[model samples]
Target: MENESVLIRYIKTKKGLLTVSGILATISTVVQFIPFYCIYKIIELLMLGNYSAEGLIHWSLVSMGSVLVGVVLLYASSMCSHVAAFDILYDIRMDLLQHLSKVSMGYFSQKSSGQLMKIIDQCVEKMESFIAHQIPDIVSALIFPLIYVGLMLMIDWRLGLVSLVPLFLAVAIYALLMGKTMKNNKVKQYHDALEAMNSNGVEYVRAMPAVKIFGLSVGNFKRFHQSIKDYRSLVMEWSNGFRSGYVLFTTLITSVVLFVMPFGAFLISQNPQDKTLSLTVMLFIILASGTTGPFMKLMYAASTFSNVNEGVKRVDEIFAEAPVKEQDNVTAFSGNRISFEEVSFSYIPGSPVLKKVSFELKPNTMNALVGPSGGGKSTIAQLLLRFYEPTEGTIKIGATDIRETTIDTLMQNVSFVFQDVTLFNDSIEENIRMGNRIASIEDIRRVAKMARCDEFIQELPNGYQTKIGEQGVFLSKGEAQRVSIARALLKNSPILVLDEATAYADAENEVYIQQAIGELVKGKTVLIIAHRLWTIQHVDQILVCDKGEIQATGTHEELLAGNPLYQKLWAINEETKEWEVK
Candidate 1:
């Protein structure tokens, strides 16, 4: 409801377009009464006096002109309203996107890609229906109904009261049936759609290996089909409720109109001397059935607009998210030194994952954060990136706390390459150029060639212009990683966060990737989180983090000297990688 009010305020801001649409709407509604007035005047003149054919023709022409005016107004209103609606939707989506960008990385960890996408979809749908359909329909339909009811009362209050009984029943029934569904139906439908999208997205990732082992050329579509079937069942339930309710309401409106209309005509004729009862007013009674147009229009409007409620709820959920925090006295970067002083984090409160953890990395040095699985190694990089704020203590870039700096400023010095290698379904040049869109084509190509993607990119059918398919699906894991390295290299930030940047590489590819890393680490501060033993061997320092604390911190050789965990893990991996057996 707050979202609705905000949307209304936004729409009202476009005064010129809304005013035009309103004027058009008014013209359309006024003409609804004009036709009855025209028939009464034209017919009475013929019955009473000379009733010249030309005079009748003149009245008929006026009526035709009114009809034409109504048509023009309707068309204009439709066009202008649609324009405003689409523009509003576009602006709302942009606003939501901007808000999402401004919020901290903590928000993303708690939100799924599918859920956010669902929110976006709902925002668009709500704006479209409210701006495009609901507002205009309310004016057009409600005005006509009020005019009909008012005129009926003017003719005879007694008959008017009688005439509205079925409508009263219909309105009561509609409220009982449809109003009961207002809240839950929208929520149910929204979650159903979200579940379907999430399921499909997850299965798309998880079912890949099985697909390849079976030599399947295309992804199995059964999961997608099941999701659709589930959605269909929910929709059917929703539609059935409205469909049955509509039939009942329409029948009641019809029965009331039929009973009251004839009885009123009979009552009027009994007293033929009541000359104030004009023929025009009498025709209104005859056309009382047509008066149901407004009620029918309202019924139709409710049916269609129920779908928009789900959209509005989704939009509301997005808008409810709090904005990002702002630190008043932000500390700017001092140098490239990184440190964690008893810093720790957890996804949920109370059950802490990382306890009081601390470490420091010297400027322009390679530091490896290593441990067994479920250790807090990746979590350390996540903290440096400020994806999740530490639960306790502090993380500092240079000598300043990360919390003391703005996110953009903090990230200004950061270039993180994670396990996933996601590229847009775009050209190789454009994908790498995302590091900095304004970078020169020459620089982009230089970075690409440096990262070793230049060799394979040139071999592609479209060379640098080759489309990488969705998420770079056309490229193998190692190939995609090289492209990602090219992106980070082009970024040229002071701090680098590399998490398994060479995981997919073969021996030859690994050698090339390591050299790329060597060039990457020349002057920038680097933090490495890896499972591979080779990645940790020659780093300037190694911090083994587990369960949110630094279990050991020293040179790899020094850790093997003192820490049994580090020593045993190293022996296992080193033996696994030995060139020859004893």
Candidate 2:
């Protein structure tokens, strides 16, 4: 019953095709039993001494033809199921991708790539076996039993009852194994172990370089090693626990002949009449024993229902996440000024990252936000991008509230160059084109020159067409920073946010990047979040932030003379610059 719910939930969209497949398979199963009936009739005729050579030959041909047709129908049924399964997989993947695209970036931060990949790839793939093969097997297993029982009863009621004894035992054993106390908990534990192992494995692989540098062995990687051990232990425990029940179930289902033969012989001994009828009944029982084979196959297929259930649950959980809301009627802003009015936010309740933060940046001016690492500088920038909404207060662009505008409109008017740069596996030109998809090759080249990306990009084998991989055509951190700057330059938005944009650049790259940033921020309302005090020494205004609050608002010299925290931070930066190897 639980397995039925899982199938129904996922197969909702593909129900029509699955229904057709089930119907065809059921028909095929019924046809498959035709030969068994034919054989029984041939034996009965021979026992009655009414069979001729031609009659025997005709019955043999009929049995052979039934088997052949049954095979063709089974093949056709499988083809339909495969088509439906693959189509369902495609739809599932597409739906997941679309949902993820709309979800908050915080979702990605909370989930590892490995975990998401396992759900999207492995979990979805696991459903293929259930949909393509198991569905048909289940249908045939269910329908075959009813037809088999009826045929057996027609021969002899005593033999029919004997045939069902093993089936009843198998069912009882299966029920005990799948009862609430064991099956649900054990299956849940197994899936949890698998997910943990997948996530830990990905984390370990990603940290391999650091591990090697630190002379770390697999045993030293505590979390990854522990996850692997836990998974192995859980699998072994489940196997050991379920082994006896599984063996008993298999033995009982297949040993139907054992009970049938003994009982048939007992009946014959008691009656001592109609010897031919007795022999025919025993022969029919032998042929009917094969019915348990389909039931055994059904049981094996049913075992995977737990995995399918887990996968569907995970997929549904992803779908349930709320995306950033956008107003249907979007308002247009007339200017580039930005403002935050009493804005506050927290990734978790009772742990505010930004507390009642309020600030405003005038149009076509440079402003800087200087603060410590956890002083909410990055959070402020992300809020403007609508990566998350303020739990309280309002953020606005020009004269209109940001919430009043569509996300697409908000993105179009703002550009960001953060410390972390992510470039796709595509060509350099293609990566730059992401900023403005319709930008021409000439526009791309111009921005590349302006952002100083052309300097190293031109040196590559294919220049702008060069492909990138994790290890392929490696770019220095500074060069990658310049490419990101080129993307921002091509975007040419009215508002620009630079969060440690030049953090990775060396002295030479820093000079080039600053020059490029100068061109990109021209006549734009810009907010710069920097740790290095020297970089923003000449900005139009500086807001000193500490503990999620603005401590002071002044120029570099003003802050140095006015705010002790700012003065101390500046002093530390100055001291670091003068220090050298002794």
Candidate 3:
């Protein structure tokens, strides 16, 4: 795929915006000469008017018309540029998201949410500037100065040519200054890193309780403040560099104008050989001097150009990433029969997590995945649903290898209830109905009752309509879990995966949730990743995963008698339960 972003490449592909953009840029470029033309016409009226009333009115109206036209063109130019910019940005965002779907799960695991946010923010901001203002502005800025210079040359070649001293000097200084500014690429890197840290820091700060529980929020305030200070100091350094560069460039430009331009004007005026009246020589000096608008701005706009380029590169990388697959073919699953063969995986190379692990799950069978930390039990469930591809093996759904099938095809018939549930800041019913958006109110109430959610949901101030707040903070942890289960039940997929959703729940609520799980799993192929021993006792088949391979796979009684690791884990969990009761 081309590295060019959708904003740049899309217009070429569509050619729809190209015409409008060209028309707008042309108008802006032509209107740039209005100021030069007006200056010449204004000076003529004033010089030849003879202090007449009608002459003053004539000049005033002409001056007013030029000013009005310039204003109108500038405004219209800005509007057209902005329109084109936003249109491109809209297309780019959609394309970016669509490409993101192809990116493998490993890519997601390797990136931080904060870093992702910065890429998104910077991309949109830079593309906006490029499309809305920079392209046309750069074009007009470059040509306007040349246009002014050409007009002056037509008036008097010697004076027009000499007036270029300031423009050349300014450009020289501007180029040198820009070189110095470009040396601060390190500053850009630091800024992006800081933005990522800030984004991650803010999210964690809001979830302070979780951090405190895990004893992880220790260096937040100090780290965040220091980062802020560092970012401020870095920006200040870049600003000073840019400021010195601009000032030096503009000063040299102004000096050339003051010293060289007027002297040339005098020389041209003193020419006794040709007497068309040297009036235009003076006009040439003023108009040619106006060329510095682009010259002086080069130093400033160059910084924005660099920053925008960096931003676009970051966004373009994401937009260019190969997605998982494009599956416009939304196929439905017939029935869920999960299978794994010669499955091998490693989050990091040379550190294998699952090696040659194989498993077969019969349709509508309840199986419990029992394992210690890092035992790859959760990895199995994640693979069964194609959250990731096996590094060296095959996982199949029905008769098709998951990779060969579209993600939507498998996912449409699978519902996942994770340990941590993050609900929206909307109504309870809305969150549950997210599974089946068009589900009727009666359907929502029916699923809630089945999942034991209606009893508490009805207790809320507005019942189904009550806002849950972010992550459903308005409800207790137990209630959130119930809402999650209700969602899965509403989804009513053929296969369901539960990741210890009952872990932090109280005894009564845990029992209630377990009952709801049993109901939901009645006719579905259920895969459970259990952290505790008691969870697997009711499962039809229990796989005791020690490291990567399943050491034992059988009923609870069979595993307890035959598998040593299974026995040890069972005894340990029983002791812990007894200790809890004591």
Q: What TM-scores do the predictions have?
A: 0.86, 0.90, 0.87
Give per-residue CA lDDT, model 2, range 1-582, as digits (tens): 433443366588788888889989999999988787678778877877878999888889999999999888888888889998998888889888988877787898888888899889988888887899888888988888888888778867778888888888898888788774254587767767888889989988889999899998888878889989999998888788789999999899888888887777777788877776687565657665677768886787767776677777777778778888889986888899889899999998899998888888889989999888898888899999999889999998988999898888999999999898898888999999999999999999999999988978888989999987655587878888888989998988999999898898899999998999989989899999998889999998898888888878888889999899999999999998998899
Which of the predicted structures, 1 or 2, would earn the higher lDDT when compared with the native? Answer: 2
lDDT of each: 0.77, 0.85, 0.74
lDDT (Cα) of model 2: 0.85
Best by TM-score: 2
Q: Superposing all C-alpha atoms, what RMSD in Å does each candidate have to the true structure?
A: 4.1, 3.2, 3.6
**Worst lDDT 10-window in candidate 3:** 272-281
Q: Candidate 3: where are CA atoms >4 Å away?
A: 1-5, 13-15, 49-51, 180-207, 210-237, 253-257, 268-278, 296-301, 325-334, 459-473, 579-582
Kindly list the per-residue Cα lDDT of model 1 for residues 49-123, writing each as its tens digit. Answer: 769888899888888988888889888887888888888888888888988877667787667666677667754
Output the worst ten-in-a-row residue range by lDDT, candidate 1.
Answer: 275-284
Error in Å for residue 313 of model 3: 2.1
lDDT (Cα, tens digit) per residue for candidate 3, span 98-122: 6766677778786666667676666
Clashes found in each candidate (C-alpha, N, C closer than 3 A): 1, 0, 3
Rank list by TM-score: 2, 3, 1
